[model samples]
Target: MDASHHPCGGIPSRLPGGGGAPRPDARGWPKGCPSTVARERIRVPEATRRVKPAAACIVRHNYYPDTHVRRDAEALVEAGYDVSVVSLRRPGQAAREALCGVNVYRLPMQHRRGSSLRYAWEYTLFLFLAFLTVTALHVKKRFRVVEVDNMPDILVLSALVPRLLGVRVILYVFDNMPELLAYLRGWSARHPVVRFLAFLERLSARFADRVIVTQEMPRRAMASRGVPRHKIAVVLNSADETAFVPSAAPDAGRRDVFQIVSHGVILERYGVQVLIEALPSIAAQVPGVEVQVFGEGEYRRALEEQARRNGTTQLVSFRGFAPFDELIATLARADVGYVGMLNDLVLPNKLMEYVALGVPVTASRWPTFLHYFPDEAVAYFRPGDPEDLAAAIVRMHRNPASSRARARRAKELYQDYRWSVQREVYLGVYSELLNGVVGASAMGSRVGAAPYQRS
Candidate 1:
């Protein structure tokens, strides 16, 4: 089913922070001073260099180049935690190697994504192997915390042994299973599968000592399921300034045709196809318009076919994937950065990258986005409406001054949501967890009994 027809709750239409907003400083930044140092070299305490990390992280995928994970792990290391990462072994990744002061461990396993049964088999095997790997590492040298980056939400179970041994378990929810499945399978909230997955999601959150959500909607989802508000942390996936700072030559020169670009995972619900559909219309108005896609996924071919059907085959260009530096260079030269995602639940990294580089953003005006970005910083368009997106493109093309103003505000807004702010928020959570500052009842409630057993 096309995402437009998915039976789900309608996103609120009002803009956030307009009526009454959270104090920007109170949100995460310091009360008086701006913190932008994560862009520079992170300082590691020589005194604590040899000390054990505050936590050990187990990510299902290889972490050598995962931007956010790498950024946060480095922050933790610099903050006196001797972090270790257990990740998948890619084609040539060493089974054991250290990167950026974090000791790395690899388990040999391949992943598949086509079928439900295949996913279950792979996740189950990973849950089992990751359990053994983390347990052994803990026995060798204990860590105070065990962090799991969830895809298979229940993989937090891998940290059971350590939690039983007095370590804290943190489940970082990159994506929630319920909404993901409902959106992906085009199932209604009332669907049995959706309900079952929601049950499992709550179950996993209940088992973890603390839950971290990448965005506010997921936090609400957990809280609605009876998880205490305090037990969950909202760690916005802010961009690291080192990698996403404003381009040295942000406003170089636009080609005869305007460039609209998006770089990230190619997913159906993300509404990139809508962007492609809008291209033909955009070209009608702004004859100088091109769409540059710089990512790959199962959805790529479908988008290409759609472009062909829309007669935008020549207008939409897929550059596949490239290193971050190359992406930055390409984006620096773009006239407008595109983020047309329809999912109210997702906030793609492309949005942050585009805004940081002072590129005018044209995104689906989902309410959750309003919470983070004011309407002025990002041009609003109806989700799943290609014409609306085309209208936005035309507006930017016609009134470059207004577009430039929005881009300037976007760059200014980016500072408040930088990695420095989130790094501090993350460390604060760990500090509370490590210092026994969180309410004891909440900590004890989850750790009393973890759901999995590896023995």
Candidate 2:
């Protein structure tokens, strides 16, 4: 009794609308009876007929609560795509969870600072784990796109399986690895290690269907280094305005203590030591001036010791790693926000956060900062010079009216780089990539018309 040869098998011969059984046809079955193949071709239920959303995955070595990754993932979720993030997991965090509509799968590894070999081992482990995780997820969820955020650049290779399956791949370059390595290790660009990093970067960029950079500087850097201009898109690291809005309180600016705040990873290259060194002079000029440092990193102990040596330990408080809401409240109440990075290659997100919150900024006069912020919008100080920073802080304290004006100007300038505006640009990049129209000329046209001016 093979079902294929049975006239009706288990299926009913009569249609739903009939009042009586239908008459048999020449084949000795009811007229208009559906054949086995026709039965299999019945219409799907209306509820199940809707199109399934395309799936997207973000692969980064960092842990969750990463502002950039979270922002991008949530944006994709909002755009009706099913988004998943594969990232490092810290102790006490769940291995898998849904956050703000984005599914996050945390690997059982934590990032640690260490020597070159140690870093290599860690990256390799994460790369292998990522490769396995993405491949498995794609088999189940069928990811249409995979985006890899790079530190080693070659992490983009983890998506090889997905790319081979015709999934679009994106390489999001947060830092130029070669330039950063050269800057951190005092290596020349022509050094063998630096050249190797550059080669890896080019390979990663070529492997990816598209490359995304934080700003114009990196976009140009990648292009000049032989990355196809059309393959690159500029999506800035602007502050999320909803979380960094100006305080509505009338007394938000009326602080009894003149507090200066700097928040982010405390790295020497970021020049937090410069701010601490300038504290004594700043306190001398502006009485009761308090410097609040909110963040934690390898440089925290060095900065603390520097503060003690400068005899301004009492004035500078190390409030390490406050929650995002707390950080925003502190920024709102602060009299001035500080960004003291030592190089032009780094564009500090804290600068944009300060501006987004309408806090007057005192930042290093690096090319990257200057390109985005005009002199009138920020009180500029020379890089690594405590004396100049002290003067800049003193000037802000002495002329509150002028500082307020600069803050207003900074807020106006921030309108151009606010996440609200940049989110669309980011989504457009995805749209282009998914549509298979992402090209050098198309990317160039979009970037050229973007709010940020070219460097």
Model 1 over residues 391-433: C-alpha lDDT tens digits?
A: 9889988998898899888888777677766666777666767
Cα miss at 224, model 1 (Å)? 0.5
Q: Positional deviation of 155 in candidate 1, in angstroms?
A: 0.7
lDDT of 2: 0.75
Model 1 off-target regions past 4 Å?
1-55, 61-63, 251-255, 439-455
Worst 10 residues of 2 by lDDT: 1-10
**Please, what are the lDDT tens digits per residue for candidate 2 over residues 363-450?**
9998888888889999999999999999999999889899999989988988878887787778777777666566643244342211
The local distance difference test score of each candidate is 0.70, 0.75
Total residue pair clashes for candidate 2: 1
